[model samples]
Every structure is written in structure tokens, then in C-alpha cells.
Target: MIEPETVIICLRAAMLGAGAVCFGAGSAALLLAPPQVASVLRAYLQPVLRGAAGVLAVAALVSLAVQTADASEDWSQAISPSALFMFATTTHAGRTSSARALLAVVSALCILLARGNRIALLRLGSLTAGLFLASFAFSGHAAMHDEPTRTLQEANHIAHVLSGTFWTGALVALFCAAIILLRRPSGDQVEGAELMLRRFSPAGVTAVVIVGLTGALNTWLILGRAPLDRGSIYQLLLAAKIAAVAVMLGLALANRFYFLPRATRPAALVASIAIECALGALVIALVAVFGTLEPV
Candidate 1:
């Protein structure tokens, strides 16, 4: 049976993970997508980002309350002004959660009401998204280690998250493009879609490579030379997450090397991308659970 605290953590992780994905999609549109494709993608991404940021802000506040309650060992103290203040100012976890909440609100406002040129808005969104991703490291397993190991673990985790989010988010963006522009598209739309794929390839490939390399480094840093105990729940969940990622990678490769070059079957391309997004969602769900578990 899952504990209440575990459930809260899982919920928070899911919300934050989802928000990160949305942010990644916006960033990918701004950075990797062509202007023609990006303009269309933003129409789909803006409201999603706004909703995600709002969710993330709420999750951060709830997480902060939960952490305070745990630290005080009194449920009522979750809202006690003195207790909350002490926790927020004195504890690392509390400080991080507060920062996360603040950033989430800022990101949401930026997305919803900030008036700027297209480039300015995109730049603002990217900055907020990167900062949001960085906050996750402080509250994660990486913070448990000592000295240089902690710093290295944090860096590795951040890289892993950035790359994974970028890769998965780009897949989502690609799916949207396929749906909007590729179904009985005009000649120019078809050409734009193809150009989007070509532009995405380099960044997508790099993100995949970073995710794999950093994930390996993170596992090693966390567990050291100890063999993974198959009997442990943590190990089992970890294994499952890895397997999901591996399958995602395979799908990505197929899309890049096979379907992408052919470009004739819009339906096939859309189907493949949808499948990858589904797998990515699975991986995020697994992460929400295993990430809260202790490694043996």
C-alpha cells in the first residue's frame, strides 16, 4: 500500500513533470522549429503551457506544505505561520519548493499575459523553462550525496531531464505539425513540414544521445558499483523506466531514419509519433513512482 506522503510526492512529480514537458515543447518550437512551423505550433502550445504552469505552481505549494508537515511532524503545522516560516527559511527542501512555486507562477504569467514580440516571448519562455528544470535537481536523490558527487549528480540529472524533455516534447510538436499540416496539405505546407523534420533531426539526435549518456552516469552515481538488486522495488521500477526509454529510442530512430526520409505516408508518420508520445508518458509515470523510492 502506498503511504499518503508517497502519493503526494507522486502527484507533485507528475504535475511538475508534465509542466516540464509543456515548457520543453515551447522551447523546442522556438529553438528547433522553422518560423512557419513555430508560429502554428505556438497556437497549440500557449494555452497548454499556461495550464501546465498553473498546475506546477499548485503542485509546488502543496509539496511545500507536505514537506513542512513532515518536518514538523504535525499535520496542523502545515499552515502554522511560524512553523512554515521556519521550515521555508531553515530547510533546503523548503527553500527549493518555495523557489519552484515562485518560478511556476512567474512562468505562467509570462505565458498568459506578457506582451512582447514573438522572439521576445519565446526567449522569456525558454529562460523560465530552463530554470524550472534546474529546480528539480535540488529536491531529488542527487541532493543526498556528498561533496563533488552531489554536484556531479545534480548536473547529470539536469542534463538527463533537459535532453529527455526536449526529445519527448519535440516528438509531440512533430505530431501536432503532422496533424495540422500534413493531412492533405498544400504543396507549401508539405514542404514546410519536411523542412521541420530536417531541422529537428540534428537537435533530436543530440538530445537522445545526451539522455542516454547522462542517464547511465546518474545510475552509476546513485548506486555506485553495487549490482542492482532485482528483488528491490526501486530496482524493478528503474528497470521498467529504462526499458520504456529504450523503446522510445527505437521508435525515434525508426522515425528519423525510415519514415522521415520517405515522407510519403503522412498517416504512418503521425501514428509513429503518437506511439512515441504514449511511451514517453509511460516513462514519466514510472519516474513519478520510482523517483520517490529509495535505492538499495
Candidate 2:
């Protein structure tokens, strides 16, 4: 049987991964697509965001409970209101978890309102989602370093995650949009996809660069000249993540320069995008594993 701590770790990772996809896809739709297109896309995407937010809320609660249990060594105390309040107010991890829960609640509410067909609500939802994404940097390894380095690493990690999500989430949104278009094939759908592809190409390139630079910075900060052959689980996971990202970049390049330019079959493009999204999820899962492992 898996230990409760292990379960909490998995929950944290899943929460983060789901939150990234939710926040990234929603923000990308708002930023990259026209209002009409974005609205339509949001109708499909908001439900996903709401579901992810719910998961995040539950995970945060469970994680906190686990931490309290471990710290106090008593399940009954862990579940007590007084204990929960004490943990939330006293510990950094607890505070971060509380913040995450609040953000998830706000994000979910905004997403629901955004679905009400109000422009103001949509914009608010998008901004809230971005904030939700940024919250992840407040905890984890990024928050472990001392003083100046801690601040710098946290900022870099935020940028790295936001940029990575933009790329991955945009791909997912595009894939969903593409599927809708394929089914109907209206002139507007074709034009909208084309426009979004063109707009996102430049942004995607910039995001890739940021992800690379920040990823290297993070690795340096965490590993700090250590050799991977030390057989550390964290290092092994990091290496796997790097390789997965490299493959994603290759696929993105193929889509941009080759398949995209040639107007590859819609089915083919969709397949490629789906594959990229799958790989992106794998990277997120690895990141979750990395967060749980101790770096050396």
C-alpha cells in the first residue's frame, strides 16, 4: 500500500499539472485569439478549468491534512479545525497551500462567470487564471533557497512555468479548435485557425527561448555542478524532463517549418498536436515527481 505521504505527493503533482493546463489554455485563448473566437473557445475550455480548480482545491486540503498529520503524528488532530487553522497560519507550506486553495476558488468562480457571455468576466477570468499559474512558484524547490537566490529562482521558475504553459496550453486550445473546425469546416474556422497559427508562431518561439534559459537556470540552482551518475532520483527525473522537452521542441519545429507551412492534412496536424500535448503532460508528471524527490 502506498503511504499517505506518497499519496499526498501524487496529489500535489496532479494538482499542479492540471492547474497549469487549465491556466495556460485559458490564458492562451484570451491572448492569442480574437474576441469572438476566444469566446467560443472559452465555452469549451471553461468547464475544463473549473474541473481542474476543483481538483486543486481538494488536493490542497488533502496535502495540508497530510502535513499536519505528519507533523503532529496524530490523524485525529490533523483533522481537527484547530489543527488545520494552526497549520494554515503558522507554517510556510500551510500558508502556500491556503493561498493555492483561495486562488483555485477564485479561478473557478471567474471561469464560471466568464461563461456567462460577458466580456469583462472573460478578461477577469483570464487574469485570475494567470495568477493561479504564478502561485505554483511560491512553494516547492523554488521557495527553498535563501534570500536573493530564492527571489531570483522563484521569479525564474514562475517565468519558466508560465512560458511553458503558454506553449503547451496554446497547442491544446488549437487542437480543440481544430477538431471543431474539422467537423464543420467553415471559411471562418479556417481563417481563424490560420490567424491564430500565425500569431502564436512568434510567441511560441519566444516562449521556447524563455523556457530553455530559465530551465537551465533552475537546473544550475538545484543541481549546482553535481554529476547525474550519483543516481539521485531528482537528477534522473530532471534528465528525463530535459529529453522530453527536447523532443517537444523538435516536434514544434516540425509543425512550424514543415507540416504547417505545407498545409499538412488537418488530421495529421491534429495528431501531431495531440502527441505534443501528451508529451507535455508527461513533462508535468515528471516535474511532479521531481518536486517530491530530494535534490543533491
Per-candidate TM equals: 0.90, 0.91
Q: Which residue pairs does candidate 1 place in steric collision?
A: none
lDDT of 2 by residue, 15-73 (tens): 76666666677767777876536666666666776776667567766777877776677
Runs off by more than 4 Å, candidate 2: none
Backbone clash pairs in model 1 (N, Cα, C under 3 Å; residues 3+ apart or in different chains), count: 0
> What range of 10 consecutive residues in model 2 has the weakest lDDT sum?
177-186
User: Model 1: what TM-score?
Assistant: 0.90
Candidate whose TM-score is highest: 2
Identify the candidate with maximal lDDT. Answer: 2
Candidate 2 lDDT at 160 equals 90
lDDT of every model, 2 decimals = 0.74, 0.74
lDDT of 1 by residue, 72-108 (tens): 7777887888888889888888888778777766766
The CA root-mean-square deviation of candidate 2, after full C-alpha superposition on the true structure, stands at 2.1
Candidate 2 TM-score, C-alpha based:
0.91
